[model samples]
Target: MNEVKLIDMLSYLEPELLEDDYIEKDMNKLKNLISKISESSSLITFNKGLRSIIKIITFIIASLLVLVGIIVIIIKKKKPKITKKAFNFVTN
Candidate 1:
């Protein structure tokens, strides 16, 4: 059996967005939280550490997700088939 995620199908529509690249929603909030944590932690300096790198990566991903979602939504809305023929074929 071959299973593909919704994101996988959407990636095909975008030439720049690869299937391997996952951009999550609500990531902006999470990025802000990470920044706050980094700032509050004296032991961890995000300015010149791995945390900074992670923050930047997250910000990029979040931006991408938002952009893709908006573009796709404006294009069209996706929904499952609900006709009797569709159900009959599934039961067969």
Candidate 2:
């Protein structure tokens, strides 16, 4: 005759592994939290990308302004030289 142990028989019972209502509720809450976190992470990534683009545009505009200022100074310096040449020519 073969004899089965109680522990082995209990392990084969399907009803023993059934989840309670609280466990199901907690699982749903966890799923919702995970989804919210994923959504927020995507938003943060988009904001970071937008900030970098804005910074690049600002830097380009500042560089162009500086270049324009340098050109203006060079032109101003040349104007006096031209005026002096004209004055000397008129006096001669």
- Residue pairs in collision within model 2: none
TM-score list, all predictions: 0.32, 0.62
* Candidate 1 Cα errors over 4 Å, as ranges: 1-48, 77-92
Candidate 2 lDDT, 1-92, residue by residue in tens: 23467667767778756655788899999999999999999999999999999999999999999999999999999999999999999999
**Top candidate (lDDT):** 2
Encode model 1's per-residue lDDT on 17-56: one tens digit a residue: 5545355545767898898887778455544588788889
Question: 43, model 2: CA deviation in Å?
Answer: 1.1
Cα misplacement distance, residue 32 of candidate 1 (Å): 39
RMSD of 1: 36.0
How much is 15 displaced in model 2, in angstroms? Answer: 6.0
Error of 2 at 46 (Å): 1.0
